[model samples]
Target: MSERPLNVGLIGGGGGAFIVQPHQRAIHFDGTRRVTVAALHPDPEVAQAEAAAWEYPLKGYDSYDDLIKQEAAKPLGERIDYALIVTPNHVHFDPAIKCVQAGIPVFCEKPLTLNIDEAKQLVDAVKEKNVPFAVSHTYLGHWTSRFARFIVKSGLLGDVRWVDSYYLQGWLAARTEDSGNAQAEWRVDPKKSGASLCGGDIGTHALMQLRYVTGLDVTRVQAHLETFVGGRSLDDHFTTYVELSNGGRGLVRASQIAIGHKNDLGIEINGTKGSLVWRQEFPEELTIRLPDQPDRTYFRGSVSANDGFLKDLPEELMAEPNIPPGHPEAFHDAFARLHRCFEQDVRAYNDGKPFECDGSKYANIDDGYMGMAFIQASVKSSQEGNVWVNMDC
Candidate 1:
């Protein structure tokens, strides 16, 4: 690891923010990345309260530009190495471009920016600076998900035939958009949410997860996106038929108005010889079905069942010292593990040593651009009576 800690300046993490707590916890989970929240730019009162709650004592600013300037004035070694962008979709581009242009790396939230044009600009900025960047596609770090990738790579599945994935949530079932809920308000507004709500927000997660596991690029997409709630401008539910680059077929569906469904993101892959099923709700288990034998359940930390990736998980993340097998680890723990890997890479880069996990191994600027393209293609296809549109990125 590096001899010096990487001082991190957070752009938008305030009190009552849903993601601020998790971001702070994940950053400090590993001792290697000593993240000092040098500056926080939120509402003055909210920022002070959040700083107190997280015990961050460096400084607090209401102006994002002032924070950037203050951090830039520090000595070379003491300057911020990265800025975490966790603001709303509409607020993503400016801070991201500013940070990258200032020669600081960025760990941006999903969707990159509000629209394709903004995303393209950010992508160009990253390339121009040649600074390391990453997007938080945390599912790529799940033990079982990585194992699924291994299964496909091992050819155990034997020429994958199809993939089915879904991400459903019921949080916005009601007219929360009309009720002025800040998160839902911006999410349902076309100005802030962009073209397709369901596709832009969470459908990107499903697509990224599927591509990561199967190593298949989407060649084309035929989509039907809808807004069920009255007076809503953006789609609340979306379904798409996908053709993969390797001649495989797939289906993706995401809905926020699905009643009684809470964070139910699941994927099922079918191959010539066998099949695999995994659900985010029960993230620790992977169901496998073989041609001849009955179905088997593979747990995260199982000795008899786990593949190389699962067995190679950090010792502390294992299920237990001794048990029958097939114990479960929760989702937050998986997210923490992803953060740990990111921290290792940051430290390695600082120390001029080989990074543990390649930043490109996870999502990056290209993935963000692809996601924007997916959103645009889905919206266009939906508008054109579910016609197929090429997403050859």
Candidate 2:
């Protein structure tokens, strides 16, 4: 039997779009999944040029509504199987809801929707339609994340007790939010960006990472979220104390206005027996510190130290990989790996087989809901003078 290819319609991808290219490349790179750009919706000339560059025979549209309407007119099987929403945070909900209601699956960018209510509405729509959907939380795809999971599962880090995670950046240190940098503008606007800027944006990533490796849900949080950059409508720094369901404690901080910092997201988890640390800057190496033995370092793709999950990566990706044992795989590779997992699960869903990664196992509607809840609770707590807020995720 021949496998059917998935027709993908992209909502945003103009000449200078940042994320669309990675999504396109990831979908096309895996031969098992033949992805065709069914339609590109942007400024007509730019979209047409992009389609031509990709060698897609499809035409381009200037409006998303036109693209959706035309695609919906096709028969179910011939219609676009999935729509990738690569627009900004504020632009995510409407296109996604339309696609899901039309019986097309959707892969949306992170911070699923603008706020808790919007996120819930999108989740309800997808559930009502019973379509397979996913959100892009790319850091969960890192090799070091896989290794950290192994250490926790193997009981090498017995009974995790505490976690410390941070995501810091220097780009917005000087109030760039008001300068109309397309990305920064919407993100700092309360109307478009939703509440809790730094926490709502990158804090979701940190929370997802914490849960992914340790399998613990955040039960409550006491937070101090600050808008350090003068005149910015949203937060630039977030410091929160988190209580986990499994009796573990955690501290999470995300800052976009921190001067002199780069893209630094690092996590340290301490357990009864030992501790494990992974830093995004050093994506290939995991630090292991045991009570009885000297601290050790585990490297990705190493014959001696590679864990099962690391060893199972596609040979092509493993061969002459960007990282040596001590070197690192950059952000794009992590994004690609996540896209690969999304593709596998989507195919499995279409084929009536068990999903390669359980939708619930990865971050899903519930995680999105929880992330929003975290944002709301954190903000409420901050306004109330740093009181503890219960999160019902």
Candidate 3:
């Protein structure tokens, strides 16, 4: 039976928020979900104004607290099915906890929260409330990302030896924050962005990509967090040499000062059998290299299970919803994939049925906590004279 579209409420995304745009498009991608209401800004007046002037019709509240209280009071069908928090780093914890306590599913933006302590609180809250929650690690939604996970975790790659997960950008190469760029302004501030700017922003994405693909945790880290731009309170370039739980070594790195690189996020994994490489710039394909053999390039929607290189493909993955092979799914598609998976869990929760918010479909609240722990470890390692530090989760 076809169901009505899931209603989603917005906690942030006012005053020219960049992340909110992709999320908006993604939520409505399948016609199964829609943003019905929003508390758009920090200021109550501005939030109401933005809602009133919104391109489409939506209910506006003075603040997230007001939005939460009123929405939670409604019956299941009338209230929002889930809430999407696109607020800054510092605003994540409060609203997310409130949503969980209110029996509302939440899909929050990452690094999760401003600090490890808040992340701990959120982890506990989600566990206690047992609500469906997700952290927005966008690239994980890519079809090729799931394909890579199948290849590595299924032992096609043999025992992992080394991996390099990186996200690079050049937009913040200069002091764009000083020039009245709202996004850059909060990002470079430690009070708002937490310990490390580059690490908290995109470095966590690299870390998560590595973890999701390799199915390994970073047990320890030797990091070098650097601030290339002068007068910045936080690091603009973040790098960490990591010890994986499976006895493998890897690097999780990100930089905002690498000129000419625009969202150049990619991952390369080296194993005893062969290697796998994926780049977001070319989102449609992944390259595989094996000893004394031809390099095989696999494109989305164009794979056969019984191929020698790939075997025992899961039916769920093969049956995952997508357009055609060469149709070219990009940023918005990736976001939509995440939200689509999230919607199922929300539906199950509302029906009082078992639902898995496990990392298999999308990053769960635990993944969000781990991201915070990693950043805290990396920052401590860098501050302690670039010494190795064990992750304190």
- lDDT tens digits, residue span 152-173, model 3: 9999989999999999999999
TM-score of 3: 0.99
lDDT of 1: 0.76
Question: Which residue ranges in model 2 land beyond 4 Å of their true spot?
Answer: 1-4, 38-58, 178-180, 303-328, 354-362
Model 3 misplacement above 4 A: none
TM-scores of all candidate predictions against the true structure: 0.89, 0.87, 0.99
Q: Per-residue CA lDDT of candidate 1, range 272-307, in tens?
A: 878989988887788888877778787766645345
Return the lDDT, model 1, position 46: 64
Which regions of candidate 1 are displaced past 4 Å? Answer: 1-4, 38-58, 305-328, 352-361
- In order, the Cα lDDT scores of the candidates are 0.76, 0.75, 0.94
lDDT of 3 at 94: 93
Model 1: lowest-lDDT 10 consecutive positions: 316-325
Model 2 lDDT tens row, 258-307: 78888788899999988888988878778888776777887776735345
